[model samples]
Target chain A: MMNCQGCRDDLVAYLDEELEQSMQAQVEDHLERCVSCRQEHDSLRQSYEFTETYLSSLEPSPYLWTRISAGLRGEPMPVRAPWSWLAARISNSAVAVRLAAVAILVLGVGSSWLFYHERKLTGQARQEMVQFVADWEGLDVSRVNPFLARHEHPVDELEANPFIDLHHHDIKNPFRHEER
Target chain B: MKRPKTEARAEDERIGELQEWLQRSKQQDLEAFHQLYQRYSKRILNYIYRMTGSVADAEDLTQETFVSAFQNLKKLKDDGKFESWLFTIARNNVYQQFRKKQIPVGSLDAGGEEERSEYERIAAPVRDPQEEALYSELQHVVNEVIEELPEKYREVFVLSAIQHYDYKRISEIVGRSLASVKTDIHRARLRVRDRVKRYLGQSS
Candidate 1:
């Protein structure tokens, strides 16, 4: 025999006829032994039946079906396509492709011009270093060991010095795409 | 007279045919596409209406739902539960509307929200009036309570209680385990029961 609480717990399933025959028999035995449980079960049973009956009778508002049918057909729905389509269009069109190629050509010419310009500046810098060394030698203002002996440092030594190479090395190429 | 009977029978046959066509439509059958639409358009509309509470939005969502279903029918892994799959899409569209704050436009009634939170809450408050006066009200409460449930629970309860689906069928429709479906429905019923008790107490 089932307890009142157990019977009550299974009441909803029982009312819906979902319990197995053996379980249903146990519930019946419990209900027979307990009137309060029986009464509560009866009330729950009535409410569920009432809810089902009530809900079925309530149809969707008039024209609800008509409007929904129209919608399912995509007759008047509005939505925008995604942005990737625009990017694809700009990238794929003949004109866009040509424009990209022309831009690449312009960039290539500009880079070469910068490289040549840098090389010319480096040559001018080396020439200036040589002139400065010559002028310093001609100025030889440090003399006069009573015999007026000149401390002659060779111009070639100054020219061949590592310091000259440090100053003469080209500044970094601003447009160099490749790592130096 | 013969033509009217023939037409009615034809319509019924067409609906049955559409259900069949829906399966093939998942494989990109255009003929199935047209036939399915002819049969299920109204039913889908009613479903959307119940979800959104507005005919205009229901109509728009219904159209989008079908077109999307049509386009992505291939993505439906389970063909036997096509109607459920379709409704899932429709449900998603309706939820999307709610997310956009477009449904029940122009109102933020707290009572409405409360009623909507669980079927039992709204249903419990309903009095036993004459069948005519109370029937519509009961339906209203049912709709409201269903609306109030958390999305996952509400979906199961609506499928089982309102749609009258068996737990196995609902599980198949929703792609969940049968046990999970049963538990969701049970929890949903418990929530409704609490609401009903509260409503009964307040009304009395």
Candidate 2:
């Protein structure tokens, strides 16, 4: 008869029905001959049976299942997004590619818009600048108050110097003295 | 003759109905998606709860799994393998999580991939539980014990003990040989047995 330890060793496999035919026979022989091994086998079997029962009886959390079912209805579950799966399957480059295309389109449209606006603005600025210069040139200086309402020129006094007038007055007498 | 014909017609009609549902779901029909959800939610929830130790996380993961499965159902190559495919998707999701945790257990490295697969064979060890009442406690202990075990062993233990997957399926899941899976499971069981015994002795 095999000892308690030998039966104990095989007891797990026996409960699982995983032992080979030869080993199975050996365990059977040991069980029949050894009371201690038999008791151990029974305990081990019960333990395994207990585990199976308990495991099977376990109920999943109710609220979580409710959310899961709801999520199946096209609602996104935040906490369980399976980001790793998403990451492995979807690349940032794909998104970047689409975004780059969009940016190029936007830039194309924006550049065209700016070019049109800039051309218009430049034309307007040139027109305004030319109109300003023409208006300045068209100003009638003869009618302009600053030039027409002539302020006194101190130089006119020099032109009409009293000394010169006196000299002329006296010289006129000297030239006409003989005749007088 | 009429009865047989009617029965055949009925079976065909049922299959046709399910097929239509499958097609509608693939077409992103919300109502169809809901119908599918209603059909399998409970079973899936239970399955997830068993796989994951937390009822809360299981529930959340279950919902997430379904949402993902619904969105990607169109990608399924064979609609007939929906059950296994769905489960596989769920399994993939779960493994992604374990991988995300980035917790490394010991290496099961054999020389080549074959060498590595050999380690997986003795990885999952089924620990013995003494009684039915202690089963739940045992499961809790089992989960804890698995976490404590090396990575290769943990994978084997989880697949065989908690997930109750056959060696062939586990072989496919882990990409190892059937022989390797068997050995890994055997070794895992032994480790679990020793750990649980020690843990129980300490607690008592």
How far off is residue B152 in model 2, in Å?
A: 3.3
Measured by DockQ, the strongest candidate is: 2
**Can you tell me the DockQ of model 1?**
0.06
In the range A1-180, model 2's lDDT, one tens digit per residue, is 556777776666666566788888888998998888787666555545544543333333334545655566556655543443233223345654676798899999999998786556545554554444334335333323221222233445645876555333434221111332
What DockQ values do the models have?
0.06, 0.08
Interface RMSD of each: 12.8, 12.3
TM-score of chain B of each: 0.60, 0.55
Give the lowest summed-lDDT range of ten residues in model 1 chain A.
A141-150
**Candidate 1, position B105, lDDT:** 29
Error at B186, model 2, angstroms:
1.9
- lDDT tens readout by residue for model 1, A4-114: 778877776676566789999899888888999898777666556655765531233334334434445556533322332333334334645787898899999999997
| lDDT to native, each model | 0.61, 0.59
Error of 2 at A72 (Å): 4.4
Question: Could you give candidate 2's per-residue lDDT for residues B1-204 as a string of tens digits?
Answer: 157988999988867776777889899886777667666666566555434433444456676678788788879887666665666766676566557755332221111122212222243235555553354455456545655667677766666676676676677666788778777777777676666667778879
